[model samples]
Target: MVKYPNGTFAAFRKSVGEPTFKKNQKSNYYRKNINFSDRGMTLEQMINESNKFYRLKEIAVVHKKPTPIQIVKVDYPKRSRAVIKEAYFRQESTTDYNGVYNGYYLDFEAKETKNKTSFPLKNFHEHQIVHLTECLKQKGICFTIIGFTSLNRYFVTPANVIAKAWWTQNKSSVTLTEIEEWSVEIKSGFQPTLPYLEAVDYFIADRKSKNGKYKI
Candidate 1:
């Protein structure tokens, strides 16, 4: 199923057809429709596309961290192919993505929320929080990219803010107002889709004023 910008879902099907051109046509009649709407892309999908653009432009090197799965059983349906029948997590995974950007070790988790007023803390795992804390202790640039899907808003929240809330506030969720006050709101864009790296640069500059850091 694919979701459009208008909040409607539908099963996607491809149509089979061949291009028919008029005889003696000087130009191609088929026009390529450019969609900047980023239709059917989830928050993660947008980020992934942005990361690809970054990589292509040599702006940053970031990638989604794959969870380590241990296969317990496998089915050999044929000699040339085998499928995993059972598997388990090797251990609790850490963040969603991590990489280096302009000499700073970047580590972050990405999350999407449908709630308009607040973002539930349960969307994050304790292990993930611990991992971010560890990265922070190493002087790494750590943060979270949160998307309020229902509201079409996104924020780049520093890891320190999240750690503080999780350890001290003991709250069930973080209010949207609180997030706005503590995080940098980012706007979606073309080419890269999600322009999160700009917010990252902002974070770097802010950190430099406080602890002396930088960005690309």
Candidate 2:
């Protein structure tokens, strides 16, 4: 059974309709001159760049999960590059990314919200919650990078905490004050852009201490 409503499905289906030849031509024309500086990157791009930096520095082995796609049509402009003419995105994604860091399994989702008061629960999916629960069962570190666009603040909130609140919210929605009380605030940085991993480290350390297993 489809999880989302038919209207939602129709909207995405309509968006997937083949681009006109003229639109494709225009896209090709602009592709070469597309400037990264002019287009401000998404939070996901910043995280990927930070992951690259971490990899180069021998800190972690993390990368964004590749979007699954089914290529229906392709245009061979030249021998080197094959332009994708038609494609359909595959099954729903479980999480934004997952990998290993310091021998720990790391799984997370990245999200940005414009709401000043609270991060909405609708941003998460049932599949993601199940995936996180499975990961936590195996003692993997599962978390989310929540970006508050209005406040320009970010937080690394654990999946377990979120899950509990999400389930509780079946009766009612979780409030902003609750999130502020539970989540760990992450300060933006220069070199890595978003130093969320630092917050993760601290969270892990604190958890270990509570369990009487803190190490020097």
Candidate 3:
């Protein structure tokens, strides 16, 4: 039986579409019996590990923001047991990671795509852009670490570049060619997993050389 408002099986199929349910199924973050160090972990996991490594070595203090949740219902089935039945996102999150590095307030977001041709704009949230803009105004170092999983390429693109593209571009995505010109690709390393600070250093150096002041 079709549960959609269309009701009829054929109509429901047309509305729901075929293979989309499976195609949209989220992939597992962890794989059983697989060596992630060789297989590669998710961008989030890699970044988390890198942050821990950096902190332990007194390199930086980056951390992920905990998104607030609104609890709707709770059930108490036992004397010491309480289960959350319903919850919702309280509000839009600012960005993924933020911290201090060498007297600079660093703020950034990490994103990944399987598409080889372009990075779609749909992956970004409007509130994130607004937050980045605010950070820029405060002279905070802001950027995005984008990974093209299919191409095995990772880039540290400035937040301003992305913000401008989002506002000026007429298309729904930023082309790979454009990103290559605008971004600095970071080489993957075994020690830090994602040594993104290397790219950040390059960006800061360029900014300092360009106008004699490197605030962002």
Candidate 4:
């Protein structure tokens, strides 16, 4: 059996272990060519890039919350920049990204899964659910971008739907078939490829109509 350097048995695990793909792998190529691919850029990178595009075009303002770093040690070199010698992953205090678009406070999380069917509930945490619930109560436009690696499909599943499912799944895990049914499938394009805001528009329209507050 293959053993990790940490002396843990590695062969029995069905899914790829940590550092599954090489850091320098051709992620951008896969992002451009593969459907529902989370290849080159991480979900955080994709969202940051999209936000940059949006900001450049005066579309909307969005940004990723910087990952807090607890620097335990640093190496100061005489002729170069100081390198982080040791650090621990700090607990995140907020959602992945947030910003404003057309007067709406937008908040969201970007997640990727290798599962061919349904994304596992384990991917999300209770804190995130609580945060999203608070955002919803305040009328923020909250949602998530789910990447299905094996099937090459990306979807925008609204926070409300996710919260309900997440609560129900406390008793059982959600199924892949269920995600396919509820998610708004995204088709990547050239400019602002994901075009997720359009999905947001639809969601807003549906909610307004349901509440008898529809306009235009």
Query: What TM-scores do the predictions have?
Result: 0.76, 0.71, 0.76, 0.73
lDDT of 2 at 190: 48
Between which residue pairs do clashes occur in model 1?
208-213
At residue 98, candidate 1 shows an lDDT of 94
Task: Return the top candidate by lDDT.
Answer: 1
TM-score-wise, the better of 3 and 4 is: 3
Model 4 worst lDDT run, 10 consecutive residues: 18-27
Which sections of candidate 3 miss by over 4 Å?
1-40, 74-85, 211-216
Candidate 2 wrongly placed segments (more than 4 Å): 1-39, 73-87, 169-173, 211-216
Looking at model 3, the pairs that clash are none
**Predicted candidate 2, C-alpha RMSD:** 14.1
Tens-digit lDDT string for candidate 4 (1-216): 111122222232232111111111111212356432344665556667678888999999988888666777888885578877777656645578899888888899888888786787777776677778778778888888887766666777767656666666243445666655555667554556566776667656656774421111
Candidate 3 TM-score to native: 0.76
| Root-mean-square deviation of every model | 16.8, 14.1, 12.3, 11.4
